[model samples]
Target: MRQPERERPTWTFLTHHARVLLEIARNPEVRLREVASGIGITERTVQIIVNDLRAAGYLDRERVGRRNRYSLNTELRFRYPTEADVPVRRLIDMFADRR
Candidate 1:
């Protein structure tokens, strides 16, 4: 007998970059390995995405001893016209855990 195929989503509302950013926002001290593991991506990819975000001025990194810390530039406006007026912080807050 033939088995039925399982359906899976091919897309999501947020991109991998957004997911990484949100993870960083939630824990500035989080490690790249943790982000990669949590998001199911490679550590190298996480590093690249982090570099992209830093280059775009969306994030700032500070070296502390052997570890690095991140700080989000929440005041920056969204890149798209549809949400350009909205601050990045608002978006982060939407997905951030309320405690």
Candidate 2:
């Protein structure tokens, strides 16, 4: 018998979104495949998160060359249960400042 695929945890989704926000903030020109590789998620999942983030006012991305350049709306609050205290802007800034 074939084994069933394991379901992704809820935290995985949240982390994916957070990582997506950070990636866009830092480069604003990253490819979905890169994001997927960095976050250990599939490209399709990243796309879904991008759509959700955009709808939630967390990201505003545009096409640039073959990749997408993004503008994160850091002012937006997270809709996820975790990392609710930290605003998107603060999260991205925190990550950037570490460099």
Q: How does candidate 1 fare on TM-score?
A: 0.86
CA-only RMSD, every prediction: 5.4, 6.1
Instruction: Give the lDDT of residue 30 in candidate 2.
Output: 79
lDDT of 2 by residue, 1-99 (tens): 322346544454346677777776767787888878776779999999999988888788788777678887777776668857767777677785543
Error of 2 at 35 (Å): 0.5
For model 1, how does the per-residue alpha-carbon lDDT over 3-51 read when each residue is reduced to its tens digit? 2335435667988888899999989999999999887789999999999
Off by over 4 Å in 1: 1-8
Q: Judged by lDDT, which candidate is best?
A: 1
Report, for all candidates in order, the number of backbone clashes.
0, 1
- lDDT of residue 49 for candidate 2: 91
What shift in Å separates residue 28 of candidate 2 from its native position after superposition? 0.3
The lDDT of each candidate is 0.88, 0.74
